[model samples]
Target: MISDEELMALMRYVDGECTDEEATAIRAQLAHDPAYRRAYNEVRQADEALAALPLLEPSTGFNFRVLNQLKAEPHKAVSPISLRKRLLHISGIAIFLLVLPSVLLLLSSGQNPVLILDGSWLPAVGDRQAQVALGPYLQPLLFVNGLLTLLLFDRGVLQPWFRQRHQPPA
Candidate 1:
């Protein structure tokens, strides 16, 4: 049995890929070794068979047809506007579901609300003497809400407007 290296050398020789020195060594081996000669003959016959097959040519308009088919397919990319609108809706729902109820609860508590910080300047609600003590949370909650509102506005409204303004006429 011929080794894999010997078979590869025979294939390389058949393909004219072997160096002159390597080809000479393979030729000597083929003359002396019957197994080497048989492998070389098989490799050469397969190579000639492949070379004898006719080359295939595409029909006319093949490229155009492929391009047209590609264009006909709907694009799979998600639109930025739709994504922004979705985010805006989700944020709005979150604020309504989470923040609004807390604010309402705080307001409806009616008992003289404890003020953690000085709220003397705050006006009384109805006949109450003091303001609702929103504790240390009110300022931060309002600030976060303001920031979220700005972010939603930028993403939902300003970004799309700016993109439209900057886009080349197309």
Candidate 2:
């Protein structure tokens, strides 16, 4: 099948000059050929119809109304973190943590493990260690953060020093 460009070229041939080779071929095809004539007529009709359609022109007021509508619209705020993304982040952190010690060990494979301590906390840590060895009281330090938080509520919010401060003291 001939391309659209070839058909358009045939239309130009109808106007006037084309290469002798193209002209001769087109002449042979168009002569005594009703089908080729009909096809050329159809192409001319389609081309004319396409050229005759009205072109669009935007109204003078279209720009200002659109911009005003945009300004009147409330801006939407979207959360940066989703539950699935948060879970994926936590999983990535876990994977990093699980591999981190092994990676560090591999990097420092030639070095020996050494004790790490702060000089100021040595006495306090020793006192706690001695308490843990002796009594159940020292178990709180292992999980004192949560316990202390709840204990503060008990000591401050729930506990009553006078039992009736709202009423005049007897």
Candidate 3:
């Protein structure tokens, strides 16, 4: 299919509305591109046909027939959301809002949340050398842990809950 831009250019070329440079470019395209040429011909034919068509007047009963058809269809009542579902949605939003602020406040307070790790299974970082060596990797380790937690949370809880909530009743 020819793109809208190409179609517009062809239409303008057909209508003698394009500049000389644009018309030349379009003419080159029409000569070299079979698809573009076909599209241009189709547009030109449609425009000519529309111009040749006489102005049409609707029949005297057209409005009456349309109104009668509209009246024949039964009206549908929109069902309000159930109270339980509404409450569930509201609670989810409320929890998110509350926890977001608490998390932001804690992070902004500049107090480092301490982690107590059991490193007894691993080789001891004797003296201060190994600890210093591992210090650079601590941030990356924390970042990976946070990313994994979020992925697991999304897969296990968020996705299931969302699917259940949005799925239509069978």
Candidate 4:
């Protein structure tokens, strides 16, 4: 016939988990009920007995226990290198595409227009032309690829590495 609040208060008294206000309420109730007071006394005695029990340091194998649990767990493998390699390979290909043409035209052919279609630059580059042609594209592409690199590896590589490094060095 006890209310939830009353039962919880009684349980807290039993478990030695009651705050001062909770204990006061429970005490007030016990003053009105002799049977409840007896029960409360018994629980209080049991809680105090438990508190008086001896304490000991944790076992040496606790670290190993945690390590074993981690080892037992199955985790999904995520790799950013593949994506970065793809982007870098693409970027390298783009570089080879642009620069290779200009270099070959300047060196082997010596201003030949016939090999113009095959990776050869007909229009010579100037300072303004460099910025106008490739700067905008390359800068943004590199930044985006770098951001993608950060996103791909942050959860897998960065978080774990930082956690490992800062974990009290045990």
Question: Between the candidate structures 1 and 4, which one is better when assessed by lDDT?
Answer: 1
Candidate 1 per-residue C-alpha lDDT over 54-166 given as tens digits, one digit per residue, 9 for 90 to 100: 99988769977886677354444878989878687567757755876676576567654466444455555433454455646665776677677667767767787798699
Return the clash pairs for model 3, or none.
Answer: none
Q: lDDT (CA) for every model shown?
A: 0.75, 0.58, 0.69, 0.62
TM-score of 1: 0.42
Q: Each prediction's TM-score against the native?
A: 0.42, 0.26, 0.33, 0.33
Assess candidate 4 and give its TM-score to the true structure. 0.33
What is the C-alpha lDDT profile of model 3 across 111-168, one tens digit per residue? 5644445455556743332222333454565456556556555655677679879976
- Model 3 RMSD in Å is 16.9
lDDT of 2 by residue, 1-170 (tens): 55677687677776555788888877787786776777777767877887799998778699777866774545545456544554554464555456556545644555443334444568655634221221232234324534544554444444433443564532
> Cα lDDT for residue 159, model 2?
45
Which model scores highest in TM-score?
1
Evaluation by lDDT, superior candidate among 1 and 3: 1
Better of 1 and 2 by TM-score: 1
Task: Give the number of the best model, judged by lDDT.
Answer: 1
Off by over 4 Å in 1: 1-32, 52-54, 72-97, 115-132, 135-147, 153-170
For candidate 2, list the clashing residue pairs, or say none.
Answer: none
Residues 114-136, candidate 4: write the lDDT tens digits.
Answer: 32132234344422222123333
